[model samples]
Target: MVRRGVLGYVLVLVGGLVVSVLPASSAVASLPLVADLRSSTGGRMLGLAVVVVGLGLASSAWLRLVRAAGDLGVREDDRTALVHRATAAWTLPLLLAPPLFSRDGWSYAAQGVLTHLGLSPYVWTPSILDGQVVEAVDPMWLATATPYGPLPLVWGSAAAGLTTDPWLLVVAHRLLALVGLALLAWAVPRLSRWSRVDPARASALVLASPLVLAHGVGGVHNDLLMAGLAAVALVVAARHGWLVGALVVGLGVAVKLPAGVAGVGVVLVTLPAAARVSARATRATQVGAVSLLTVVCIGAVSHLGVGWVHALGVPGEVQTPLSVSTQLGRLAHLLTGADLVDAFRTAGSVLLVVVAVTVGLRSRSGDRRTALRATAAVALALVVLSPVVHHWYVLWCLPFLAAVELPARGWQALLHASWLGGLVAPLDSSLRGADAVIAVGVAVVAATALVQAVGHRRAEIRAEVRAGAQARTGDASPTSPISR
Candidate 1:
């Protein structure tokens, strides 16, 4: 197991090193050697090849780590410790590497600088800033105001104060993401125990997932922080009470609004198992009040007002294929030659609210496990039905889902999703304008790796099923000579 982890770590590190050389829109211009390499087509192709191979290797390694985590002979505490150590080791390579998979880190740095200059990120675009910071920002977001809450702005402002270098500032943001990762490490196991799932298995699923590593950590996304805090909130609420949970989730909301959904779980878990409708409503109201109060206090303290609430629609401006509503809208437009994107998006939003309310109402009288599942369901609904869906958005519910027991097929689906999500950015980044031969080769390799991984998991599942059936038959057989 240790050897497998070491191998995985080495593969990811090698891939990360190659990725570090690829010219990102937000990359710092200080590395002359890397710059020279990136300026040449051959160098770029070599880097792409290395990156593709690295991703395949890393994906395989992650699969092995997850599989090893499920060994029943391993004690739960030992499994948890193994996952934690492996996660820490795996994170080391990407810790200092340039932001992987996305340019949002650049935006965070620029926004932080804006905040430090007493400019409101909620109102001011990163374009307002001058120098390397603004240069590193993606053009699409250059003029777009950030819809993120004030807490992140404040966090960014603190990092900006420490370093004027854009790369360093982005690294600072990565450190913030690390804090979130720490919270997940601490919270996932407790939540898993509450749900009667294996702590190590759940920890491996969330903390060591390729999706979390590539996007949550490598991308330096604030979603990591939000998800971590939300997970902690659910666990805290389940153990301590709803008030503490409300406060924790409120802090999460201040990082990203979607995290506010966890507040429902907090409320539901605190209600009596046979609570009346009025009682449920009252508890929800109380939790909502505390959460709202927390957000209001954060905004006031940060001096960045709650204007972000109005700008929540900012992300919807971009269309992503992952968004069910966006694709449906596009399909409608294609068929009817009419623009119905907004209508579809509005309908999706309405449906999400209805689902959240229905789930909350039905789960309010259930156990903590049910509340946790309900929260996960609402989060999944939010991502699926939102106007814009980024791959990392799934992180919002990943911890909760990991804490719950899932069937073999469900785990298989998650594994596939994680593998694909981890590959999306590297493939997209490396293949654009690349030599056709190289692109095709890389795609074939990735597809083959995925197929093999899936096939291996299916085989393992079949073996486990057969073993279970044999064990059941053995238990049912008589030990008497007559029966023999």
Candidate 2:
């Protein structure tokens, strides 16, 4: 474990140094600080190489951490501590770097600029900003209003803070994201214990995930913040009262709209059985009222108004790859030679609702484990079906999914596949030509890895079952230690 920690930290530190010194997006490069490095194509290529290498190292380190976590004999608290230490070692350097791999960080700063100007982010684009902030934001988003929730926008407003420097604002926003990581670090282990998962294993799965650290913290996306808060809400729901948990979940949704979906599982868990139809309905109504009211009250306090709802459908306007809706749209066109993009999108939405309802109903078993699994199922269904899917969005489903124990190799398979897929795929564009080829290559590798891992796990389970059966049979035999 110590060796793995040291290796992971070294690789992460090197990666951070490389990314920090390298030129970033064009908008960031336009700044005087990195003007010289910006012009060097070779330098940028070298930096990219370093970043990829770093990711590989981090991925390896995670495997080692998983191995450490597999020692069930270890104290749960001690394992949690190790996971936390590993997270800090791996995350801090990436945080210090200038938004390692995505231009979205620049967009975040620009959105903050818009908020600072008292413009409703839902109605106006960053193009309204007439300075470096304009250049910092991607043109794709220039004509489109922000789809971010009000809480993140409000944070952006504070981050903007009279600084015309886009870099400063980007750093400020990243710092805010750091707070969210801290929240996750604190909440995940507790949530794991409450959910009856091995706290150490759960912590390792979440904290050491490349998707969480690389795309989440490194890109400085607000989704991590939302996820952190949502984790807290889940923990509260399990250990404390439902009303307070409802409020916390609402706060998470205020950061990003999807966080509210998790509340469905929370509410379902509180409802009585279907036999008590009227009582169940009453409980449902109360939960809905409190949850929605909490969200509205939080929005009101943020002063962003409810206009943000107008942007809720904005993400659908952009078609991202690897999403169920996007692929379905393509399939429809291929089958009928007609554009059924909108129809397919609507279908995906309907499918997601169906899946969420099914999972929520399943959660009515009233077990915290069932509720968490339900929450994960709903989140996974939503991400798979959503019109827009950033690779980082996978992180949304990870915490709860991790809480449900699977065999170590099964979890490893998922971790490797998700990490590889997330690393290769871009959120904004469909994979095509060479990019598609490369993504396919990565998928093939990940699939192969999964098969191998799954095989090993199956063997282990078989062995365990055989051993248990033998022990039972031996115990039943009267001659076996006098039936002791």
Candidate 3:
């Protein structure tokens, strides 16, 4: 145990050190940690190399936690605390440094600046902060209004109120992410109980994930807070009744629209056990009340009024190749010589609704497990089918996925591979677009293939064990031999 802890700590600290030494993301004009490290030809390559090595170390630490977790349903000392410590150690360095690998953090700061100035973040672009704030924001988002929900905008405004220093505003966002991590740490144990998974392993998977650390805390994305709230809501609904669940999930929705799925799941899982007409009527009424209450409350608190409704669709306007919908749109455009982004996005939204309906319909009466799994499915499907797939978006699904058991090893590895690839994708752009796509593609393929191979081996071992047990039973007792 001591050895494992030491190794994890070492790997995490090394990764943190690497992050400290590397330059800030190329997208931002200036970063506190990289002020001295100007963008030179060789310096850029060295920075990329450092990123690769640091991420590798981080991955190793995560794998070690997984292996050490073993098959125990409950661990002896509850190493999740250790994992959290490691996460903190890993996060501290990045928090002090500029946002690594993405300029979205800068946009977040710029939005906060606008909010502090008593401006509607949903209405105004970062252009209003025309001097340093505009320079801090990526040009792509400079002219575009913020797509974030009202709660985050409020929090950002509060952070910006602390100091006019753009860097300090960024730090405030990171601190908010740390608070989210705290919420996650509290929720993971309860979720493991609900899902019947090992508490330690689930905590490690959700809390200590490289994607969570790198994109979540390091990028200072508000998705972390949304997901943490969603997880807490799921657990509360499982332990308490749907009313409490609805309220908490509504709070999450106030933070981000994506979290609305939690509210939907809460309602689905509250279906009555008897399946009687009366029972169904009662359940439907309760759900409707919860839903209405959530909507009214959320609308009331939305300082930006209904303008955020328009801003909600802003992400769809940007066609990054990362999204499956955008990928299909590109393919369709290539084939038909017309832009199909809107059509593809519409299809994606339809598919998301279908997934929700399917989950709701298939949920067995009085089965919390089925409902929770459906919730997880909805969360994952939302990100997968969305028109804009940021790496941080994947964080929306991790807690839910951690709560449930993945059906197959290959599928589990595939999920990890997806997020792992997401973590590395930004590094490619940071490398001045020098073969990042191909490199990430090759890394993903190789990692998934390796996982598949290991999964097959585990399957064979289980098969042999079952076969041996059956053969031993036949040899020991009345294996009624062929009478003929």
Best by lDDT: 1
- Candidate 3: tens digits of C-alpha lDDT, residues 238-331: 6788888877776677677788777656765666663554554565467556744665565567455545667787777667767898899889
Checking candidate 3 for backbone clashes, the offending pairs are none
Which pairs of residues have clashing backbones in candidate 2? none
Order candidates by TM-score, high to low. Answer: 1, 2, 3
Could you tell which candidate, 1 or 2, scores higher by lDDT? Answer: 1
| TM-score against truth, every candidate | 0.90, 0.82, 0.81
Off by over 4 Å in 1: 1-33, 364-366, 428-445, 458-484
- Could you give candidate 2's per-residue lDDT for residues 1-484 as a string of tens digits? 4455446445544433433422244454556634643345444334434445455556666656765665554666777788888887776666555555466787788888888888878788877777666664556677777777777778788878767677777778887777778877887777666566667777777876677877777778888888888878877776665787787887887788788776765665555444254554465566567767876886678776777778778767667676778888888899999998888888888999899766655456456666777787788788888877777888788777777655656565566655664344222231122353334435544554465446544744654565467668774211111011
- List model 1 lDDT by residue over 1-484, tens digit each: 4445445545545544444433244453335665655666666556555555655556666666676677655577887888888888778777766667667888888899989988888888887677777775767788988888888889889988888887788788898899999999999888888777778877887887778888888888999999999999988887889899999988998899999889789888888797787888888888888988999999898888898888888878778888898899999999999999999999999999999888887774648888888888898898889889888998988888888777767766776787667755565432335566356546755675667577656857664665567568884222211011
Query: What is the Å distance of residue 380 in model 2 from its true position?
Result: 1.4
How many residue pairs clash per model? 0, 0, 0
Residue 285 local lDDT, model 1 = 88
On TM-score, the candidate that comes out on top is 1
**TM-score of candidate 2 against the unseen true structure:** 0.82
Task: Report the Cα lDDT for residue 90, model 1.
Answer: 75
After the best TM-score superposition of candidate 2, give how far the Cα of residue 175 lies from its true spot, in angstroms. 2.3
